[model samples]
Target chain A: MNRHILSVLVENQSGVLSRISGLFSRRGYNIDSLAVGETEDPTVSRMTIVVQGDDYILEQIKKQLNKLIDVIKIISLAPNVSVFRELVLVKVSATEKNRASITEIVSIFRASIIDVSNSTLTVELTGDQEKIQAFLELMRPYGIKELVRTGLSALQRGDTQISQTVTE
Target chain B: MKAADAIVKCLQKENVEIVFGYPGGAVLPLYESLRSSSIKHILVRQEQAAVHSASGYARSLGRVGVAIGTSGPGATNLITGIATAYMDSIPMVVFTGQVSTELMGRDVFQEVDITGATEPFIKHSYLVKDATQIPRIIKEAFHLASTGRPGPVLIDVPKDVQNDRLDYVYPQDVSIRGYKPTVQGHMGQIKRAIRKLRNSKRPLICVGGGILRSKAQEELANFVTKAKIPVVHTLMGIGALPVDHPYYFGMVGSHGFAHANRAVSQSDLLVVIGARVADRATAGPGLFAKNAEIIHIDIDPAEIGKNLGTLIPTVGDAKNILQQLIKGITSLATDQWVQNLREIKDSQKDVLFEDRVGVNPKVILKTLGGILEDTAIVTADVGQNQIWAARNFPVTGKRQLLTSGGLGTMGYSLPAAVGAKIACPDYQVVAVVGDGGFQMSMFELGTMAQNGLPLVILLFNNSRLGMVRELQNDGYGECFGIDLTGNPDFIKLVGAYGFSGIRVHNDDQFADAMKTGLAATKPFLVECIVDPKESTL
Candidate 1:
């Protein structure tokens, strides 16, 4: 099995995102994490997709993605070279007895408490996948109530764009 | 100008002399503007025929073919042909009408998401929400369809967008950021291929549809001659070289010549040009040129290693790449390989035998070949008749044969001939079809009649689906759904559509009917009564 990140540039059109993700699900491939947002140009959107599969699945995904006309470009970003981040918000149960301890744990993990209730604390954190997972695990001992994470968003460290002009 | 009028103007500017379309509820405004346009429109009976004809036109002449249909069923009917062109990489731009923007998702009458339906098939599609986007969308659609491994492009126009007026501003250039197709091959790769070609004692050139699409036939022939290589063809790659050419080996596939397959197996080096090594061409990936060092030349980068992966992948335009390769190559002496392929071809020449009193499709197609010349364009429907045409039709040195090779669309020939004959008026156009596939798009006879296209409809009546039956007979004990219980009397049926019908039950009568059909100024239908169980192979 191989894990690859594909930074997809697509025309900002209705149902385009649904079409891409739907194609993956229908074709029976795994999308580990998918994050999409407006790029520098609003007319186009950038999607950072994390997928896990063997060579056959990778080739199929590449061919299938190219077939989608809404997709403008797909650049396979190397995990070692590019920086990616994920944001997670977790609400953990905290009694007055362990509130000070939980606050200390939050400070150590560099997480900020967004809201403080008498029984629960909502902490927001931003980090790489590993950091987020570790933080979630650390807070689990304090009784986790809820958890939400924005999927990975990444950008290359270089200046080149996959949006090179194609002449007819 | 109205958006519809602007569209007509844009089509005119694109030099689209002819287009095929059918009228329906959603596309009224576009059709209304077309009444006064200079471009000629051939009204097809069904929406499916419109797309088929357009693709036929594109296949015949290497220009982008235009086709149109309205929403719902009209657009849905075009799906098969769209997929056909997509698979074959035939350049076609299809315009489909949509419901008004307000009623797009409201379950409105005659409404369907045409772009969504065609998403998997087309190279690109545009759903114009704004009227001002019409001009740019039209330009982009044409460019996308005809460029870079040509395939179908669709533009779905909402009814409201067509009605709304806008200043017509056509984009002079299409600068798509992500669609750069390499035209010139990497020089280093070309040099390496030439060196490999020069060294190989048993070298073969497997030309395909891409050579025809790229109009690189002359260059390919030149390269083959200079390299002293034998040429093998896939089904879609027919006519890349003259059939009578000394080095031209016959097609390679299931129904293809045994010699060609033998050549692919024996060759030390296989130079594949512009053709996707489809399963039909390879049979299976296992024994397909396994011993040969394969060199793949294709326009699409994705297609290079998609199927039977190659050792040397040269991605670029065939003409440009061959032109570059020709410069460094002098003379490749392969007299023994050439003689070996010649012997294999000579052994397979007398394979197909004749039946005097029955309609042998092979005999029919061969007889048609005897009557027609290089100027004739034969569009074949899917199944057994297509196999006969592919196997027996002696057409070469020109882009004359068109078939739904990749998609295997059942009813393609009749409408395809309509479009081909319309595209090239002087050429003798013929539609070779089986009884099973004939009924699928037989209504296009009316389109032929209305347009006055002097086409010969060669109906091969086997009284069953020959390929399907062959499969059942070989694989299953009993035939269930392959037989046609009540096929129409084609000769009599065609007479009502302004065609002179001639029934041929004997082999001797086929040539005469073809002569008559070939000479006729109006439409003619020559029906061949083929044996029901005859293996097309």
Candidate 2:
């Protein structure tokens, strides 16, 4: 199986999210990650979905997604042609002894400590999947108390916009 | 003007002549509005039958069927009918009353989130929060239900919204940015399909209900005759081609004919039109047409490669795609292939159960097929009766067989027949149902009587859910809850509804009973005793 990123534009309606998620579960397709937010146009919303499947399964997913009446357009974002980022907040257990080392590692990764107490430091990081994974690995020695992530949100690298493209 | 009156005005704007519904507390306001309107209303015994009847109306006339019900249980009851229409792509617009907006989430009396409940099956739905949007919403609902790959759309109106004041102005046209359906096939794909058909030595065309849904039967016939391809159909595709057509093979599936299934397996190339190649039609997807190249044409792109692998995929209306194919096609040299299929079809003997106790259901259906007019409409309920009608009933001229093929809802035929009779009063409408399924919606007999519909109800009594029993006997080696031992005397039941009926015990009695039933001016029931051990092959 291969991982694929789908950028979709849908009508910004109350139950649009449920319709998209319901379709995935009903069709037995697995969603690895999903992030949705209002688009530039208030009437439309953009959904970034990450799914893992073979070519046939991916094609079926795309076709099925297109069938939903609220869904306006769907574009597959290839890794090389798209910019992907995820924002993660990690609360690491910190003592006075290891505080300097944690700060050093945060600086090295260009991540910032957004919140801090004597026992723990909360770091906020935004980067590609690989960068975030590496930072999390380096912070493993300090012990992560709590963590939350906004799943991968993506955009095409070129001037072409998903909303502007004419869907076939 | 009141919002409820505006809703009625919107229906009028859509040219909806009739609606099927059962009124309840939540929809009282809308019912009041309908009371003074010119459009006719059918009060079904149950809310489920309302939707089924509407489906029958829609399928028979190629129009968007309209049905209404109240909130909570009323809306819940329409779920099966909605799913049935969705599965078969029947065009329908359904209305459900909602609890007052304030009481929606409080678990008040008669409150249910119907739009949420039906999201998976409905084509589109709206939970109306603004009364001022009623005219626009109703217009959009009709457009969504009848356009593109047609299916059911729903509108849920709270009682307060129904009574709220609003200026009525129905939209003249619909333009939804997210919902444009392809009406014309891609030229390149059409050419590729034509090339594939021309190159193949043995080509077969498999059509489904989409042909009827798109009103493409004539186009399909012209294409078949021009291309010299043998045709087969799914159960829902029964009326797409005349049963006596020389190039037409029988229905194809597990319950389908052996010769038809063989034709599917042996063909070198398959052109599947308007069908999703569902599991019931393919029997087993992996082995279906394993050696054949496929060309799939459907309005919905999702159905193209979902089941069978397609070498050429054409996305458009079936009628439009078939028209394009006809325009580009030259005659194929498939005389030898057609001859081989004809020989195979001719050599196969009709499977019979001579030792069984009662009259064979297949023989009864065949006799009824012969007795009925060429333009008759036969609605068969799910199970053995459905298979019997689909296989044995000869569909010629404008004859149609309406069944709940996808969801296989048992009580569909009786109410659907009611709808068909209402849609085409001059045409003969018959409801072919098994004993197990007959009791499911027999209450609709009152609806028939109230409307003075002259319908012929052909009831096959086997004292069991024959299909389930057959499965148990073949697969599990034991039967459990298939028996309907306490089934009522169907003739007397009809008599109570102010209708006349007859009981047929053998083959010789069926033709005469059918003739008598057809000759009667009132609703007539002909109950045929079927053998308990008779199997659907």
Candidate 3:
């Protein structure tokens, strides 16, 4: 099944995030990406979780999550129509011989090499999950050593917003 | 008059009595001013407790709760409490003394940007640069914090501002640029919802916490009766309709009544009011009203079609909306549909009732129900205590049951009970908490003792995190790290806090303890040691 993006509003309290993630993990559901950040309202935080399931299991997970003490609301953004992105910093070893090829690859992907030393080069990339994954696979052959990827952060494509609905 | 006088006057304007907090260097001036002021200051062990206490005070009183702390560590400690209150939509105002304005942003001694740190968690935060603004800011803070969807607001006062002199004038009214809250229902949406309800055969009303917040119980009851629709309540919607009312179909959700869940699943037209259609309440969106054309009526427009995917989405106040709906409902009848719901309700009425010794949680709750008047509002925490109250406590009147259903805050019961007691002083309020949760805000006993608000606290001592243990048994296949080894003696704990305390070992003892505790003209704690293995949910 295609992954769906869900934004959850939860009480910003201890053990709330853990409880939600625990429920997902315990249910044997694999999460593609999950990112949490404070919303415009301090009392509530927005959790964007990328989960792959049909309408049934996704709704089931959402319902179980609502049973948590800190959870306030949940909304699933329309897939394909939504805009999603993830930030990644990857470290790879490059030499003078392959440096031009790596640079060419980096330019092709529109990624920037943030750090460069004699033995190691660090490239920072920001894009959708698929685009980042494609670049990572190409870098794999060039002795990819370490990678740090930020979980997916998403917003709906158009004027549709979470806060607008809650405000009224 | 000094700037301290201005600050004190601002507090008076807000009608702040008790502030839960620990004192420190940056706030010494405010603490000094507090000494001369009539406002009672509660000395909490930690700044976190101060916020939680303030949350409790707010939830119990319907007034904006106040808490204070010093800058740096003090402000950081209050983060959790503020976050907790923010999440639960409780109104609270937190005051943190900052380093002198001159030294701000330089990371001077005990200087932290409290306003910046708290920016993410507070509804709004102000870093006071002028003494004259203190009164207006304090007034506005309370206004902003308590009004609209109530939340925590922070005022970071620099030491200099606290000590600066200003001509104090308290504003009688508050005005803000973009904070107007809609108070009434939209007539157009109400008419549409009413029209849909009148035509539908299998209509079910799903209620949420918004009903309680709006004080629309009578309106909800009237609409249900006039429309002849059965109600299925969410956990937070508990007391919106009397639990035993003939039209009441029971609670809906994961732990909801079987019939209520089935009714929601089987209904052809769902009339959701004041509810967010939370995942638990719907048992997953796919199963909730899949066959029904949903009519969502909520004050928060975001809640409409946010979860269950509705056709008729109405956004407005519950009471106002219900009133409008009633006006539009033209003598509609679906008697056979109502009877079908009743039959379903009757069929799934069996919950496992274990009769045993040593004061079972259910028995204690039932007994408490018998002793208290029907008007008493019972606030229950999560875990065994919540389940016990849900299964055994009977809510007979309006605005009687208040709990943290969506967030299910474990330490929520005691604080919320305090708020409910303050809101309706004539009605008896009891906080039913398990041992694990009781320890979270146990210090609130001091608040009760100091305020002279008598409350009956039923502490179900299971010597474990009973709910987690149950989960472990069912899901993990074993119990580990859930049992309590050194549970606090609740009686001694209450006694230490200068309140009356009693221990109940048996059925007869529980009754006597409850009587003795309720008879005392002070707050009382009744500690009943419940068996660890038993769970109602």
Question: What are the chain A TM-scores of the candidates, in order?
Answer: 0.92, 0.97, 0.89
Clashing pairs in 1: none
The models' CA-based lDDT, in order, is 0.86, 0.93, 0.77
- Residues A24-109, model 1: lDDT tens digits: 88779899988998898999999999999988678778877876767788888777778888999999999989999989989999
Q: lDDT per residue, candidate 2, B360-425, as tens digits? A: 888888888788898999999999999989999999999999999999999999999999999999
| TM-scores, one per candidate | 0.94, 0.99, 0.73
Best-to-worst ranking by DockQ: 2, 1, 3
Model no. 1, DockQ: 0.41
Chain B alone vs. reference chain B, TM-score for every model = 0.98, 0.99, 0.90
Better of 1 and 2 by lDDT: 2
The list of candidate 2 runs beyond 4 A from truth reads: A166-168
B1-537, model 1: which lDDT tens digit per residue?
A: 999999999999899989899988899999999999899889999989999999989888789999999999999999988999999998999998899999989988988888887766678777889999888888988888888799998889988899999998888998776576778898888888988988898999898899988998889888878878899999999888878887899899887889999999999999999988789899786668888998999988777777766878898999999999888888788998899888878877554555434777787788787788678899999998999999899976463889998989999998899889988998889999988888999898888888788889898887889898888889886687987888877777877776787888888888988889878888898888877768878
Candidate 3 chain B worst ten-residue window by lDDT: B349-358
Against the true structure, candidate 2 reaches a TM-score of 0.99
Better of 1 and 3 by DockQ: 1
Best by lDDT: 2
Choose 2 or 3, whichever is better by TM-score.
Answer: 2
DockQ for every model, please: 0.41, 0.85, 0.05
